[model samples]
Target: MSMKRPNVFRGYAALICAALLAPGSPAAAFDAPARIEQNLSLNAQCGLRAFVHNLNGGLASARVIPLVSGSSAQTQAAGGASYFNGATSNIFSAVTAANLQANCGLADVTNLVQQGAAGAYAAAASISLTFEATRTSNGDRYAYRAEISGAAATTVTVSQTLVNAAPTVTLGPPSGPNSSGDYTVVATLSENSSDFTAASLTLTNATATMSGSGSSYTIVLTPVTDGAVNASVQKGAFTDSGGLGNWFASNTLSFSNTVEKTQKVIAQFMQTRANQLISSQPDLTGFLSGSDTGALNMTVTEGGGAFGFASAPDKGNGVWARLSGSWSHESDRKTSYAFGVIGSHVNLSPDLLVGGMIEFDFLGQKEGATRVDGNGWLIGPYFVARSPAHPLFFEGRFLYGQTKNDISPLGTYSDSFETQRLLTQFKVTGEIAQGRTTWMPSLQLSYTTDTQRAYTDGLGNFIPEQGFELTQAELGLDVRHEVLLPRSRGRLELTGGLSFVGSSAKGSGYASLVVPEYAGGRGKVKAGANYTLPNGAVLVMDVYNDGIGAAGYESYGAQFGFNLMF
Candidate 1:
């Protein structure tokens, strides 16, 4: 029974095969496309001729012939042309139509024609232009004039029809070709086509070399070697296995080859010590005042890389002095964000002082080969409290803060800025360091509404109503750090910062204090310095000339003070 079952399956399989093999069966009905090959050549004096053959099976001779017109042959023969070169006549390669199609293959040839090879004698062709020359021996010398012809060669045509997977030649469309955009074509030549070694795109203007994938090849035309070519035309030639020359020539002398524009990318960062670069003075000097606020620092940056960090500062305000130990981190060496805490005890009426701050900034990197460039933002919160016994030597209390920022892009004139805090306050009570102890200064400027919002409009142009308001102004300068022994724990420093109140200025409804004569003045000068101690602790000092003085005019003495960073 099993044997019988196997026989039945075999019979069914044979029936299916018979149906598929039948002449009219679907499988049998599909036929492969007919394969055809073509080769073409033209001469200046000689007309034009093309060879074609079928790849399936065809008999044809692939011989190079100097195409000639009946009229030209008769005219030349009558013009003293002799048969003296008959002895040197040599036949090269057997070429057929099939050979032509095979050479072109199924590939793109747009760049070849448009960027034709350099040199004067090299024959070049695209779908539009054709050039060739044939030399015949005349006694001891051979001479063959050039022939160049093109049908609407002034333009390039692009479309699905023009983009052939195989090389081809065609005249312009009925409407002519497009004067712009890139196009492609395929060309097939006999395996025995001429050699390109001696071929040239421009005799005196350009030169070229032969290159491609197959033994039979496609020609690429470029401008002259070590010379510039007009960026508007195509030139070059394709050499076959045989040593015959194909040439590309220009009829109007205005032809040129096209090249795509060049493009480059930019990535960088930058930072500089502006004061050091501009000032000639080696030492910073000024009176010390108020409580030490802190130090102002500048950092350099590097660009084109990512920066990551831990926690950042919240938006709030109050000032404190620098501590013995403070550490910071940076992305590409620029302080992207920072955090720390510290407290100190002074002998002044408002004695004990303590607080901490966390800061965040978004200054896009600086600009340079190694620098990052752009705008940035910074925000941090802080707290400070001091005793309240002395009026001339008293105490203060305050906290919280935030900072806003902006910058320009690489090489452009665009710029931006933002404010992160609306109110500022400082409250710290501690004994003055050294013999200057027993006295402390408190400066407080506080705001209640929209504390750390950024100024959105009129960036760079100051507008008061849109800015944060200041509540108070205090000025004080005193020496500290003398008790630390030989001033080693870094030099004692006096630091100060100002707070401007937002109010309608110039009697205008705009709430802004536009007067530079006040602490908000455009030209107020501020300065500070620091010294390092053997214990690695640092003492900092600062002074700000808030442009407002006790004389009811432009007061220029030190105003605020700080022992830490600003």
Candidate 2:
């Protein structure tokens, strides 16, 4: 009788049948009974040997069997039953050995081996046994066995030794000082901790102490200096739980522990004059000064041992021009003079008035034997607004200027300076008669700054003089009463005002020697009159005295001007 071999057993049967049919003397001399016994023993021995060889080879190479999802028939046909459950290939195609070691547990591989063995022998009538062995520790030996049961029982066992695999190690996040100057560091492991110890860690440019035991460990590092701190795991100092030396490779971590610093300083000077057009105009009801017609006016002011002249021309359509020159002599016999021309234009609408001014000024001052000369140019934009239904008016101005100073005593020790000025003012007016008497109250604020520059002394040595700032505020009230001349068909206006002025100056370095410290409260009084000519011309005269006990010096000045209207 002949028995049919299962497809799973066909490959093994073919190998044994080829061996038996080969021209071999041992099997040729055997009788029927001897041949049958010899075949059984040979089959059992060959099967056991192949099983142990494949198992040890798979484990040694860390090969991953490809277990694809499919039907049982397809899996059995693809030879998957020989190794893993429904596995189509014994080659590791998708995952690496390290990946499997990290993600797939040992229990998973053990189950796969047991399932593969059962499927490989499922067709046997008698009890078919398969064995597998793995290394439980590094440098251990592999032991494999197989047993068969039937009319005759047979057993086979084999042993082989292998070296342990290397352990993989990774690092965790490092802690240290950030940008805020805090100093602390903690280094730890990110992976593979089986046999890690505190003594296995080392540091460079820092000192380290360890905490925790076994696989996980923390190292505290104290930096010798404030800079970059580096910590690393010492090579050859780490071993796996299986006593596999040099498992965890050395790794280094770096961090910073330092701080940065930065510093800055700024300075600014400004001068503002309302001009004759805005300051001297009478606040008469139904009176428009800069409309329809133009005028030319000249002014002369003398006070504080100084004299000055100003001429302004209105070109109609809210456009104006000014030429001014001033000379001043201080108590210390310091003399200074300045000349400038200003071109300005104003746009007056129902809601707001917008205007801008550009001026170039040249000034020179001489004190004792030292002389200083400078020229400055200023550009500024201003705005004014008044509510049509109210008597309140607001005005603001912002100006920027640059000046280059030349000193005769300092030789080459002169520099350029920048300045910024700001002015804001508000006025409230109440008119009694239609165009007769008016009472106006106003408040004004001013700010100025001058940049620092190198100054020279009489010995031609440079002085590190810093910049200075000056700020002033004033509040005033003015009353104007006009007398109508029936014969001349003109008006004579008389105006009087009282103002309180407060000012402060901040000086730096040698600035105190050149610029006076002016701070405190002061009182001012002004009287002015505008005479209307029979020919529609106006004559204006004003006188003012200020700094009543609250300034560096008292000043009294008078101004006279004539306006010819066309």
Candidate 3:
């Protein structure tokens, strides 16, 4: 040589070469040839030990050479690597690294080299490879990559956007040229109305065919049906303009066909009208009085038929004039007649009803040893109030009457007397059920006081004969049930009652007048049935028993009447 490097320089050179020859040094492998071309090759001067090292190095170098060669060959065979070309080579390299890390043994680094070579070769040949690698705390790194050629790997991402709020759907009136069999239904959307174009609108009890669409949709329904037409929309039936969001399932809607005004009025009237077939007694309290302008009723008792007529003429402004007359006869040769008139105003309030009655009655008895004739005039005022929110009802009444009686053969004496009577009653009733099958329970309390004054018949002069006075108090409980008949569209009514009566009579005249025995207690029971014809005529039959100790009163009766509506 001509020029020998310094000892220190030689030492540094040797150290650099040793570093370059170390295993897993990719940078040194790339730079080692430059040093050899400069004639500074360490192999030239190294001895046997160096020779052994070189041999190892050559083996190591040969390890990856076949992989590179195979990769090139596969790339060339696959039409110049059209699938995994240079652009995708990095993906293949990453997959190779991952495969090496997964399959290599820790004791043998050469195994990793071999595995890397095989993975690279496979990636190039198949044009596709996928691998995952994880890094460990020991400085081992793992990664994942996939290479696909001929068919590129495509990644698709799907997302959903929610609506800001639920949309409101309103149903417009039916679109019609007023035909019986054909009509169109219209629906308008509060927001994004145009979205309804693709909405699926379903109609129940009818067929819907889409006719047109816009902010509002028009659907043609054929054979326009009655009853209820239920319409609903399906979930996701409509998408916004951008196809991103959808409308909420709208609330169900319904439409009914138009009904004639007259029919509606008649139906309402019928519904409001009382079911007279269910009532066995007359409106004694006037609470159940009808609005009919005029009505005539005939009832047959155990003996004779009683005739009654009532008229309620409208006096304008919710006021009505009520006038009624009645006549009755009993099998025991007893006769009675009554005439009454009152004014009623119903529109005063919905929950309260008020009325007054002024009545005059005549009674004549000509049977056995008793001959009695009497005429009486009574004035009564009554009121009923019902709590709108409850099933409770309350009624109160006050009655005052004056009668003139002429009794012949009163024991052994004939007498004429004037009688004054005062009566007060209160009733409370409650409904247990509301419909065709209804149950009502009622409680009633009554107090009565009667005083009589004696008079002389011929001279019409007052006589102080110690006339009798009577006072009575009674309490009663009544239970009533009404059931509607399915076939006849009629109603069956059942009623039962129990009453306790207490009375006291004073004065010696009571025995002389042969007054009825005043009992300390009483019991009453009743049963009745009525049937109504389609023409609003009614037929009723009833029986009742009133018992006081061993003495009692019983009767069977029937009535026929028609309700008139104007």
Candidate 4:
């Protein structure tokens, strides 16, 4: 491709020829083969442009030539200056092996002219370059000052940006192995987060309260539905200190919301089981205590539901000794087996009886991730007295004991503790007779205390069961009707009764769970029968409910036993 000469180039050539032929201004400027490439490239970026020139197939005697910057016509250089000279940014750097100064130090040129952008795209950059060619014949120099320019770039493009990595968080497991209806979940931040709280939880089937701060936070979950529980913190639900991350949601905390009481709740369960078995021991000596002077009785018993007992005692001076055994199960599936012996006495004159009993029990319980096994022995005294004038009977009993227990959690951690217990009970009753029926009314009060040594569990948690107390009261009545057997050889007595039992209590809980506070009452009904033979043989069968049982449930069962007296 070849470039067509512009009219400016032709006219400038003609003017140069006229100057050469003229007189006074001769040698003002000359013409030779000065090689120039026009509009080579618009290389202006962040303020630098470039130009190149040569003359007569060799390094040109080129220089950056200064012409009148703002002058229109006069005030310009003498004769040889070109029309394009006012495009200087006034800042320049020439690069070459040797730079040249021409026009008597008025201009300078090296191999290259470097120009740059003007004030924000004001105009393009131009440098007046005088390229001189040497004439082969006369060694005369011919030069021309022509403007060189570049297309100044108007804008710059960049690929760098400002952003931060997002933070992440995880919702830990429902706080520990929650066996109770209540539990908690901890949301832990991968990095510290300022806005993470219970409010950030996107809860399903539960309500919560929040605690802790920064990287670790806890939300105690109270299930609102008795179904499946689902909980999570949505992405962006919380933010970091730099207010950057929330790009990921915390892990989901999910479980069944149904009641699965364990740990301290199981303690209460097992405690109530122990209390029932200890307190509800049938008084096999009741019959002997009511006997006349010199009365002798022997008893045998079996098939006690919850706690069935067997006893046999030979009576002497109102004194008797007997042995009994019982086994019981709680609503929480905890079980207790016990055996005991009682030595009793009766004084018929004023109708008073005194006795003492010793017993030992083995217990096994499991709930959630905890299991406990233990054995204990207890000894206590009891009394029964009737005021001749008042026609009322009074009874009382107290027992104290300590247990050696082994505790295992999740089949992993293990430990042991000694637990002490004291049980006290008192009752009063009166009787009214009409025809073949007798009606008895009674009121009883009992209190129990358990001092379980504070211990560290397998996972380094403290069980502060130091001492838990429970008190209960019961008011009941029984009506018995006698039916004589044929030939007057035996008699059958049937009895029915109703009772109201109430209790109040408070204690420490297990691990992070609180020992629950208790204050409530329930109604109970019972029925029983006794068969008496002429030779002092008797049979007993009874079924009753007294509003107490494993982990807080309705407690009812039956007892079957027999006796012989002379």
lDDT of each residue in 329-399, candidate 3, tens digit only? 54654444444445454545767877765555555554445465566666777777877888777777677
Look at candidate 4 and give me any clashing residue pairs: 49-115, 64-108, 167-245, 269-551, 304-308, 508-515, 509-514, 509-515
- Lowest lDDT block of 10, candidate 3: 45-54
1-566: candidate 1 lDDT, tens digit per residue: 86899999999999999988876511111021231223233223322122112222211111223444442311111111111111111133222222222231211112211121111111122112121112221111111122222212212221112211111111111110112212221223323344323242233333433444433333333334212232211123443343332222223122222111000011011111111111111100010124233343332222212211111122242322221111223443432222233322232223332333332222333323222222322223332233244332222233343433333322333334333332234333234444533444333333322221223232233222233233334344333332343624454444333433222111111212221112332223455545554543344444556445234435343222222233
- Candidate 3: misplaced stretches above 4 Å? 1-295, 311-333, 337-341, 345-348, 353-355, 368-370, 405-417, 459-519, 548-566
Best by lDDT: 4
Instruction: Judge candidate 3 at residue 390 and give its lDDT.
Output: 83
Error of 4 at 321 (Å): 4.1
lDDT for 140 in candidate 1 is 12
Q: Best to worst by TM-score, what's the order?
A: 4, 2, 3, 1
lDDT accuracy of residue 350 in candidate 2: 65
Query: All candidates: CA RMSD in angstroms?
Result: 26.1, 22.4, 30.5, 18.9
* Alpha-carbon local distance difference test for all models: 0.27, 0.46, 0.43, 0.55
lDDT over C-alpha atoms for residue 566 of model 2: 59
Cand. 4 Cα-lDDT: 0.55
Clashes of 4: 8
TM-scores, each model vs. reference: 0.22, 0.42, 0.40, 0.54
lDDT by residue for model 2 (1-566), tens: 14554765898989999998887322111111221111111111121221211121111111222233331111111112232321123442322223223332221112122222222322221222222223322222232322222223222222232334545445565653322323343444433556566566676667756666555666566667544676666645676655545534556676643211000011212222222112322221212222234455666655323223333335464455544455556664444444444445454666576667665666565554445566666677766666667666666656676666555432323334333332333343333344677877777766655654544444333445455666767788888898777766678899899988787776555344334475788898999999988898788888988778663668787888877765
